[model samples]
Target: MKLVRYGAPGAERPGVLDAQGRVRDLSMLLAEMGPAQMSPRTLAALATIDVERLPLADAGVRLGCPLGGVGKIVCVGLNYRDHAQEAGMAVPAEPVLFMKAVTALSGPYDDVQIPPGAQKVDWEVELGIVIGTRLKHVKKEDALGHVAGYVLANDVSERAYQTERGGQWDKGKSYDSFAPVGPWLVTADEVGDPHALDLWLDVNGQRMQDGNTRDFIFDVPTVLSYISGFMTLEPGDLVLTGTPAGVGLGQKPQPRFLRAGDEMRLGAAGLGEQCLKCVQS
Candidate 1:
């Protein structure tokens, strides 16, 4: 099922997509899509609703981050061999984990803010995993059972703040609107094989990154189980499984970066696309 949240930024209401790709309001049946509703049982119940009967949303309504009250965003970096090589870094022995503040969460099509004096802004098209149940110290074999769904994400970053700031990558990654999530969350059952999806990103209509999940050095279950060992992952918590090569910093003729007014269009198979504009703060 394709689950969504549409309306103004903070007032978005829960919804589901109908056969024609129209928004069918679920507000009457569900107050909001949050941690509790992400559980397998609740999602199963939601799947039984007759989408054709729900009221359609107003035409062209703004979409908000699909899930409300997101707990935290855990990200894995350098999990792709090509991306690590492009950045001149070694492929890690284990998942290279990082945190993107929940505050960075934004709608899939929202404008990404470029902070003052920031230069070297970049884009990363990645597969985002949404946790459905509490998981702690779970083995890799059982990790898939805790996932609710997946979403496409653009992990907008500022290369300078991330590398030259003399601090953790979170400094450049936690900016507002840096984590534009979904047009909708495609349930686990619908996604089929999480590691076989194709992913791509374009800037101003020019293709910048074109890759596939088949190249992942460490797959989904490994990432989830590895993370759960240290930090408890709860429903509504998001995990960005990292991006493949072709980021701005990896451009051949020096590096290309985002300037105000640049538009980024990106997506993954099964997960819908995202169109975000870069704007100055």
Candidate 2:
């Protein structure tokens, strides 16, 4: 099922796409599409509802980030071997972990604010895993059971603050509107094989990134298990599996970065596409 949250920011209503492909309001059934409704059991129960009977939702309504209670946006750096080569870095022996502040979360179609003093703004198209069950030190085999669903994400970054600055990567990545996620929260069951999908990104109508998940250096199971080893993975916490090659920073001749008025379009196979514009902060 493709679950959605629609309406103005701070006033979104829970909804789901029906077999006919129309948005069916699910607010009557669930308060908000958050941790409470993101569990496997809850998704299973909701799947049984007759979407046709639910009230209709505007097909063109603004979509907010699909899931609620996104505790922390954990990220994997240079997890793609090809991306590592493009960035002139060695393939990591283990999953390199970092965190994006929850404040960075924003709607897929919203305009991203290019914060003041930031120059090396860039985009990364990634597959995001949304946790549904609490996990701690779980094995790779058990990681999938704890995932509620999957979603598309753009891990927007500022290279200057991320690398040149003396501090950590968080300063460059945690700016508000940096984490644009969701056109939908596709259920895990709906996405049987997570690694067999195509993900791509375009800036101002020019394709900058084109890749598939099967090429990931470490698959979803391994990354999740590895992350849970150090910290508890809670319900509604998000984990970006990592992006593929073709980011601006990896470009040759001259590296390109985002500037005001730039438009970005990105998508993952079966998840959905994202359209975000850049504007001055």
Candidate that scores best on lDDT: 1
Where's the lowest-lDDT run of ten residues in candidate 1? 58-67
- Cand. 1 Cα-lDDT: 0.94
Per-residue error (Å), model 2, residue 262: 0.7
Best candidate, TM-score: 1
Root-mean-square deviation of Cα positions for candidate 2 versus the true structure, in angstroms = 0.8
Give candidate 1 regions above 4 Å deviation.
none
Tens digits of per-residue lDDT, candidate 1, 18-115, equal 99999999999999999999999999999998999999998899998998999999999998999999999999999999999999999998999999
For 44-101, candidate 2 gives per-residue lDDT tens digits of 9998998889999876889999987788889999988999999999999999999999
**Candidate 1: residue 225 lDDT (0-100):** 94
Alpha carbon deviation, residue 73, candidate 1 (Å): 0.3
Residue 19 displacement in candidate 1 (angstroms): 0.5
For model 2 the local lDDT of residue 54 reads: 95
lDDT of each: 0.94, 0.93
